[model samples]
Target: MHRFTRILTRVVAPVGAVALAAAFTTASFSPAAADTAPAASGPAQNYLVLYKSGGSAAGASLAAIAQARGAVVQNYAQIGVAVVSSGASGFAARLQAADPSVDSAAATASFGVSLAGDAATDAADPVSPPTPAPGSDNLSGLQWDMNQIHAPEARSISGGSSSVVVGDIDTGLDFTHPDLAPNVDFSRSVSCLGGVPDQTPSAWMDDNGHGTHTAGTIAAAKNGIGIVGVAPNVKLAGIKAGDAAGFFFPEAVVCAFMWASTHGIQVTNNSYFADPWLFNCKNDPAQRAIWESERRAIRFAQQQGTTVVAALGNFADDLAHPTQDLQSPDNTTPVARDVTNACAVVPTEIPGVIGVTADGNKQFKSFYSNYGVGAANVMAPGGDSVLQRTAAAVNGRVLSTWPASRIGSCLRKVFDSGATYCYIQGTSMASPHVAGVAALVVSSGVTSPGAVAAQIMGTADPIACPDTAMYAFFPSVDNGAPQVCQGGTAYNSFSGNGQVNALRAIGG
Candidate 1:
């Protein structure tokens, strides 16, 4: 399994304002220290206490009493807290004794714990392999490559289009977008909040444009207005969990996952990061519950044979040096001397999810992509230049859908004035490329996320990245490193498995 390095921070707060408390006393802690506290003797016992909303008073009172009894409060959320006691015996009684307001408590012998292990010692320099010529435009043809190997290989393999449903668990989609309307699977696409049905047929409406572009990359209908998606035939189910500000809460994401699992969604694309300010969920009960819920949902998805694809975050730090970057993008002011890595790659790191990194033009890894050996299962074209246009001057760059809310915002002007299209760059963009391909693969009958990931990684063209001083820490061999940044042999960390060769991936 691959693991990205993360920075961990501790925020101790007063009982009255749990949210405000976290905002004030934020401090950095080492990953090991942040993740693990001394476990008590006997079996590791964990329990979740579900309290009524706004019942923090009751929850905190219970936590105080649990601390007195040498049981650590593992996490605290708005709804409840997850407590790990020293002894399994009589925990419910003790919890109830601590606070009678506890509505219900469920005990478990062990809770799933994710520990940052040692870095990969045997990781070698990248290797060079044969690569397709650039003009092949392998990255542009979304579903073609995936279908070549997994789905029925044909020019028009849209036969199972309606049967394959993809749920996008990202910023909301622009369901009304013209390019995406015809194929939008509105039946399954719905928002978790308010239990409202998706009114927009496209469900590709993005408040931040991130989700819309991602959705377009995955399964935008081939209406000839925008670029075709990898799984152009598949139906898309949009689940709007992220807020308008482009923020995704763990609870919301977990809820999206659970909803997707129950609603016949075969795959989901999660393109958000964890709170950059926090790391381990040990002290945060709400985060822990969300994490647990996400895992459970992922397990359920697997049982239902759904694939979950997630992006490795843009935090530019290594697993060994997870605390280096701590500056906020908006504020030059340093938030903390060091912070734990909370890249979006978490649930992906969990077994059964597909973790993706970004590369473009078959040569360089996206500068913002997070890279650790075994960390990312595959790579895809995320786009380098903001213009994302194949012909540069023609068509005024990429014609993908834009987030509905941001369509007229100042940021949207960068792409086109008064147009519901925007040009942005990040691994966030790259993830959907692989996701689109996965949908195509699923359409081709490859049902498992792991199997799709294996096919994508196994079939990619290997290239060596150029030895830019900025990427010095990235492993590169003499044979693989390209003389230029964009020109290299295949299979460097810079461009994992080379550019996602659709023709090769689909067995052309």
Candidate 2:
């Protein structure tokens, strides 16, 4: 049993505060680096240049320089540029001299930038890594328990029938992971980095572990060995929109949605959120344009019958403040104090997405989980009991998959070679459980993402308020005011539709 208490909702300090928006200018390419004469050439060269302006501009300059050098400028963007060069040696100096503003340049070969063409060929006809067979190290008995969930059983009855493809529009995925290899549709995977046009799957490999863990929850191989997934048989795809550092620029996210539309992917899971302050500045044209564009993309996905699942964010708030203060019981107004504001409740509030919140067996929303009436749609298990794996998980434990390399690094730094995995917790971990469940619903011959969402919402167990006790109390305007309880009937501004019951969800 989990304690749930209702507390007034108020705006508190921002979590993971975002810097104020900065004005940006387009990057100009240096004409000095451009080759005037046609190539009386030897071997064709490829170069990627980094500029001071931004990665997007650096890419543009590289394209212009490629044209001047008699080589073709394949693609250009703000951060970096890629070009096929006729001559190799003094290209860097020539480019620098061509434009004083140009910051620096490097050859793609020197940087070990693998082309999508090469990566695809390798993936298509490659040797498999020595991954331990699934279930080989079933060290945790959790897998066995998850198997009893209705989603997986429904998938089995359908003979693995779901053809719906869900796009993970976040960080790239580890395409080579043994648990995910069989189910991922590599053909649709794309990266928005340099405009290298081959749609081959190299971009799908997750350098950061966030996307991989999400992917695992959605469709980890059900080979009766590794961790079982909610929709183990559902088709999954990856969109490499996020960078290695886990930051996603608006351009990248927009491009990813356009790419998903073109690639025939039907469902997209966006387990990422932008800062709430962004909406506060709703008057900015650029920000408004970005938001509109996001809305358009989501609408486009819906037109194509794609379902979008988003995280409700992890910014928990108190419901009292000057900006959001409630009247005191004594009929006296007090000075406004900052209260916890539900900041993570943005885009989830956007029309099309099925926003998910994190819940544990205790049935209460995670302390970090944001709450608001139209913000979260459902809650799912995101691991509770702590297991030693990573620094973040040291306090709140959530069971899920992780990249072996990253886990090893953390283990080496902390406990030496003794640790292989860490129990972690976050709405990020919870989003996938819903995504997987959605996949299961889709696989049951449902074509509409909206329909799948409806089924999920309809099937969840309704929890009643005041059904549980308060775990703790924080000072608010009214001391005796009822705090939120874990389980409840009628939606409490916290856990929506109660915790997801896989059995009830699949209508089994």
Candidate 3:
């Protein structure tokens, strides 16, 4: 399984302690180098450049772009987004200087994928129902999260549509995994590494297991061999935006959403936040540029009729009233800084995107889930080891399909068929459940993304906060501060709307 130790959400810091965000960025990409260095060993460092709305795509022609000491690697004409590569100093500045119509320009940020803590070893812990569920596949008994969302009952009403494609835009997918192979829409899958799209299926393969696990939860087959997905009958598209190392760069994110919009993707599941800042504070010029470019790509996807579902993140912070953020510029050195409404986590806080938080079998917020009154749109089972632990399910983590080739400390391999599975916990594991539900809703006759989102909210069950006074006493995943919930049964921060009801979502 893929495990990332340094993400904004995964850092288990002492209270008031500062920590690094996932895959800290290199401070600079200066052109200075020794002559003894070999030829460029990797893809050209790319930048995400977005043109102002209504700007002419041709205005960014090759001749004009060359003036910036950069060349276009890929041009998304419809969205006015371009991925450019340059070794020149002040690459972004040079590009903007050459084109005043460009709305924003920032170096594409990189990220290393985060791994859920010790989930693989926990899978080996003794589980109840020693065998599989009577009518389910091999690992169904371990999937309490599915039952929590009523996936079994929902699937009975609608298992999702063959034409409704749900794209998993993360580390990529393992097309060969038996459980996932049957549902993967290979023709729609592509690798958007370095912001350049490669149509070859192998290029989109899951070098890291995170994408495969999320894929399983969204659309793993119901072939009586492995665990079933929330919407077992829908087509799953793998948009390989995160690289082999688990980093999700800005260029890849822009490409992924644009790809989904152009293709027939009805929905997309986003688990990781875009780099290099953990929170893109609009007050900062560079950070504002990052958010603006990524926002344009996301907004364009929604405009194209794709419903976006994203994780609220594993950082147990109150997103709406953020006070201090010690983990900015995760791709580089992080500094302690205060933030306000001007700062926002991309995709999660972005309007129109369905933001999801995590809960456990106990129905409480996962210690690591980020929440705020207006931030999270819904909640799903993300698992909790501290609160939901039981003798059978010691870790209380989410179990899903795993990549067979990837070797990591937190992996649970199946020896019989060389196929594999693993356990992980995070909003990363939670968002796909909602995305699957959204796919089912779309398949069940709700035709538009707006309509699908409305159905998801309208069908959710309302939940009230648990002992507000005791919030300060509850243990948190980050071991920093206890979490608190606000609002009533109708809406709240901890469990938005309510835990996603797959059965209700599918008209059950």
**Candidate models: Cα lDDT each:** 0.49, 0.51, 0.74
Q: What TM-score do all the candidates reach, one by one?
A: 0.62, 0.62, 0.86
Candidate 3 structure quality by residue, lDDT tens digits, 387-418: 67765455778888888787463444442255
Regarding TM-score, does 1 or 3 come out ahead? 3
Candidate achieving higher lDDT, 1 or 3: 3
Once fitted onto the true fold, the runs of candidate 2 whose alpha carbons sit more than 4 angstroms away are: 1-140, 143-162, 193-200, 275-280, 318-346, 384-396, 409-422, 466-488
The candidate scoring highest on TM-score is 3
Summarize candidate 2's per-residue lDDT along 105-148 as a digit string, tens digits: 43332112233331221111111111111232242344322442
Error of 3 at 198 (Å): 0.6
Kindly list the per-residue Cα lDDT of model 1 for residues 1-508, writing each as its tens digit. Answer: 0011111100111112211111235344242431234323455444444454444323476464454243433333322433434453444444554565655443432332321111111111121222111111222343232322232232243423456777887667777776567767776665533122233543334555666777876776655444456666667878876655554544344446556766677778877654322233323443344445445546666666678777765543333224433322211132333334342235655576766666444235554455544455666655444222334222212234575566564243333223355544456666676676666566666666678777777776665655466544332111112112433455443454555555555555
Which portions of model 1 miss their true places by more than 4 Å? 1-160, 193-205, 276-278, 281-290, 319-321, 324-345, 386-399, 403-405, 410-419, 470-493, 496-498
Worst 10 residues of 3 by lDDT: 118-127
Question: What local lDDT does model 3 show for residue 376?
Answer: 82
